[model samples]
Target: NDFPLVLQVGEEVVSLGRIACPIILTTLLIHSRSIVSTLFLSHLGDVELAGGSLALGFYNITGVSVMKGLSAGMDPICGQAFGAKRWAVLSQTYQKMLCLLLLASTLLICLLWLNLEPIFLRHALGAGQPTRAQWTSVIGISLAFGYAILACVFTNFLGEAWGKLYTQDPDVVKLISIGLPIVGLCELGNAPQTAACGVLSGTARPKEGARINLFAFYLVGFPVAILLTFQLKMGYRGLWLGLFSAQVACVSMMLYTLLKTDWKHQAKRAEELTAAVGERDDLEDGLINDSNDER
Candidate 1:
């Protein structure tokens, strides 16, 4: 009841406000979905809900967070390099991120798959434990979903890709606009394919790809998915299915957006490339200088 709300208007403020709202809401929706799923299961029975939440949180904190952190470094690099169109740097970042995500995610998934029930479920149940059928189902569901969570880390790299693409060609934005609706067509089952497309696109395009993904995931993808999931009561399956809708929209948008991008032409122009590279280098140097001064 004591919650406070504030609204203000200014050019810079509005721009930031616009960006902030979607991100906050999207992330909130994700957490809400997780909590609600637990609540739904809880309605079925307390032990089921509590135990489920515990295992979910554990896997997320230990496995999910670690992978996200390890692979997320590409965000800054992609954001900056993409704007600069440093193809060499962008290429390097993509390879490194892919390699890192693969190694880190593999190990995390293995451990999670191995101990889905033992560490997450049984520990929650304590001495007596639930029926074999129940625990077995939990283990199966947990492990089945583990592969999906692994996708999030790779998805992080997409920010860099889309960011670079946006920097290279603004037209891609328009393309993504047209493409988004088609993805919407996939309707309920778009996340896995969409997410995979995003990560690959991000890793490939770095600049525009990452930026597009950030928009799609944080903005279009997530919000749309959240609405479908909550309003339609898609449940766990629905939630995952809804995820695809966002990805499809984003990927299609990016493709349409790419129709306008002429990075190859931009890259071939020596003077333009030099100036762009120099400008980018200056920014990096400035950051390093600032860091040095701070130290």
Candidate 2:
């Protein structure tokens, strides 16, 4: 008998939530560390606060973001392996990921140590399934819109007073009030794109996600930011607006790709990826030969 559609969807939501909630909480907790640090820095004076904030941002962009992105590639492989009960594959993949991350960390450290000039600039899940792509897409789009609305609400609610939470300096508060809302709006694009990327990874198609990000951020977003910041004199606000533009492009392209996806083909690909070999092959051969002799 086929499972009821409503029940199936409900199950999917629960499953997704099971995986997502812990991650969300962990992310919030991790970020709170930075917030706590900033609060302490604020007590030390503006220059100290500014330098500390810059260092934290720099570390996030160069170190944490890179590691997270690299680690994400494992989602598909490991998820498929687990689903297919390929314990060896899952174990090996985990080990390899550790090695890769260690090497990457080493390289990043060297690069950062060698060059401090670029510090002035820049900034920066899984796929698998019981064919969870559709539900995942819905959740992603919902989050995109939800975050956008929240951004607007909070921005309005806080109004000019929002900046006072961090500092009493009128100039600093003014800068925060102007820039924070744009940064919040950026989540409208960032949220959905992040979810869509997970779907791609689940389907073992991380390269496409990578390409989309490169095109969105570097090819499109960075240029727009430079133009608005330097040419339009919008300053840091322009920089964030540029980020918003990139995020919009990213979510648009990500949704387009996900909408166009062939889920059945992805399932078949997952099966192929998890197919057994070696000892399993030999064991199956022996069983078939014995059955033939009995026949």
lDDT (Cα atoms) of all candidates against the true structure:
0.45, 0.67
**Which stretches of model 2 miss by more than 4 angstroms?**
1-4, 99-132, 277-295
lDDT per residue for candidate 2 within 148-181, as digits (tens), equals 7786667656756867766778998888888878
Output the TM-score of candidate 2. 0.78
User: What would the TM-scores of all predictions be?
Assistant: 0.34, 0.78
lDDT of 1 by residue, 156-183 (tens): 3344353233233445444444334433
Compared with the true structure, the alpha-carbon lDDT of candidate 2 equals 0.67
Query: Candidate 1 regions off by >4 Å?
Result: 1-9, 83-87, 110-295
Q: How many backbone clashes does candidate 1 have?
A: 29
